[model samples]
Target: MPSTKIGILETGGPPRELAERFGDYAAMMRRMLGEGYAYATYDVADALPATPEEQDAYIVTGSPAGVYEDHAWIEQLIGWLRQAKGRAKLVGICFGHQVMAEAFGGRVAQSDKGWGIGLHRYQLHERTEWMDHAAAIAIPVSHQDQIVELPPFSRIVGGSDFCRVGILAYEDQPAISFQCHPEFEPAFAKALIEARRDRLPDPDAAIASLDQPDDRERVAGWIRRFLDGLAAERS
Candidate 1:
C-alpha cells in the first residue's frame, strides 16, 4: 500500500506565530489519517497546480480575504475546483467554503447582518451517517462574509442563526464545506479575537465567551468526527 497524499491550499493571513500557534492544520490532518499519509501545502493565491492528479484529496484553509475579491489566482482556483469536481475529495474551510460555493454557481457576499465571531452553536439540519454524532456543536466562527445562496444540488447540512449556510455538501460529489473555522481551537480563537479586538463590536464579550469548556470540547469532537468520517470513506 502507498501513502495517501493530501494537498492543503493555504491563504495568506497572520504571522507565523499566530498561524502556527493555533496548531498546524496539516499536522492535525496527518494525525487523523495516521502514518501512511503525507501532507503538502500550496499557496493557492500564489501558485496552484494545473491538475488535481498530483494528490489524493485537497483541503482548503480559511483566509481573511473575501471570495468575491478580484484576485486573479482566486478565480483560477475556482476554475480548477470546477474542473476537479467529482474527480477528487475536497474540504473547504471558511474562505475556502465561500470560494467553493461561488465556483459551483452559488453566491457569496459580505454579511450585512454583521460579523459572526467567537464560539457559535450550529444545529445539524438532518441526521446523516456522515454526521451521526454531530448535533448542536459549538464551533468557533470568525467571518465577515457568508454564503447567501447555495448552488443547485448542494445540501445544507448544518447552520447557525448568524450564518444560514454554515455547512454544505454536493449531491454527487465528495466535497464538504464549512463556513465556520473547524481548524480553529479555543486558544487560537481567543488569539484571533484579540488580534482583531479593535475592529470587533464587542471584544470583551467575545473573549469572555471563550471560557466555556463544554463548547470547546464539543467543537473539537465534532471536527475530529468529521475527519474520521472522511478517513473512513477513503478506506
Candidate 2:
C-alpha cells in the first residue's frame, strides 16, 4: 500500500510572537496527527488546489477571520469547498468548520456565547463507524463564531450545549467538521488565551483550564479513520 496524501489548507496563522514557540497551524496539526501519511500544506490565501482530487483528503486549518468577512480569498475558499464536496474527503477545525458550514448552506455568526476558548467537552451524538465507540471527548476550542443553522444534508454527530453544532457529518458526501481545536496543545491554548486577554471576559480562567486533560490524539485518530474509511469505500 502507498502512503495517503493529505492536503492541509492553512487559512490563517498563529500570533506572530508565538510562531517561534508553537509554529504555524499546519505544523501543529502535523505534529498532533503524527506521521502516517504524506502531508502537504497549501496557503489558501495564495491559491487553491487546481482540483479537489489533487489529494486523497484535505484538512482546513483554523483562522482568525470570519466566514462572513468580505475577504476575496475566503470567498474563493468557500467556492472551492462547494466543488470539493464528494470529490475528496474534507475536514475542518474551528474557523474551517464555520466556513464549511457557510459553504454548505448553513449559517455562521458571532456567537452570543462569547469566546469558547479552552478545553471543552462534547457528548457524542452517534456511533458513526469512524467514532471508534468513544462516548465523549474534550478538546481545546478557540472561536467566537458558531454554526447556528447546520448545513443541509448534515447531522450533528457530537457537540456540547455551549456549542451545539460542534461536530457535523454530511449525509450526501464524505465530509465532516469539528468546532474544536484538537491541534492546540495545552501550552499553545494557554498562550492563545493570554494573547486574547483584552477580548475575552475571563482570560485567567480560560488559561487555567488548560491544566485539564484533553483528547487531541483521540480526535486525530477519528479523523484518520474517517479518511481511511472513505478510501476503502472508493476502492
Candidate 3:
C-alpha cells in the first residue's frame, strides 16, 4: 500500500526561452501523473545513476535529440536499459520510445516522409489489460524519426498510416511505448507547433491539424494503469 516510486529519465528539453515561458517536460509529466506517485527525475542527458535500483519503475521522457546522435548520456542510458533486462517496468514516449526500440534490437531513423507535427490518430490493433478502450486515440505528435524495424520480442499493438510503429510492447519485457506525446496539452502542443513553424515542411497543415480534439488525459490514464499493472504483477 506504499506509494510507487517512478524514475523519470530526463533526456532533453524544449528551447530554454519557451520552457521559461511554458514549463518544462517534467512539469507536464507531474501534472499527468498527479499526486499518488513519487517521481525522481534523473537528468540522464546530464548524469545517470551509478545503479538502476534508484526507483521501483522507470519512465523515459521524450527528447529532441535523435537516438543516432553521439551523446554520452544516451549511450549510457541504453547500457542501463540493457542491464535492466525486464527487471522493472519501463514506459517510453516519443524519443524515449525510439531509444527503447533501438536498445532492444530495433532500428530507428529519420523518416523520408518529413516531420510528423500535429494531431494524429492511431488505431489500436491489440488491447492489453491496461488499456481502457480499443478505439483510436488522438494525440499530438512532433517527430520525423521512427522505429522501422522492431525487435523480435516486440509486438506492434497500435499504429497509423503516419507511423507504422506507433505503439509497441515487449513480450519478454515489462515495457511499453507510444510514438505520440500524451503528456502534451493543447496549449503546449500549439506553442510547440508555432515555435517551429518555419522549420516544418508543412506548417500550415500542422497548424490546421490542431483543430481536432485531443485525448491527452485519456492516454495518461491508460499509462497510469499500465504502470500500476506492472507493479501489481511483481507484487
lDDT of 3: 0.85
Which candidate, 1 or 3, has the higher TM-score? 3
**lDDT by residue for model 3 (13-107), tens:** 88887799767888778888899898888898777756666777788899989999998888889998888767778899999899999899999
Q: Which stretches of candidate 1 lie above 4 Å from their native place?
A: 23-36, 214-235
lDDT per model vs. reference: 0.75, 0.89, 0.85
Q: For candidate 3, give the lDDT of residue 16.
A: 84
Q: What's the CA RMSD for each of the models?
A: 3.4, 2.9, 3.0
TM-score of 1: 0.87
User: How many backbone clashes can be found in candidate 1?
Assistant: 0
Candidate 3 at residue 112, lDDT? 94
Is candidate 1 or 3 superior in lDDT? 3
Model 1: weakest 10-residue lDDT segment is 226-235
Q: Report the number of the highest-TM-score candidate.
A: 2
TM-score of 3: 0.94
TM-score of each: 0.87, 0.95, 0.94
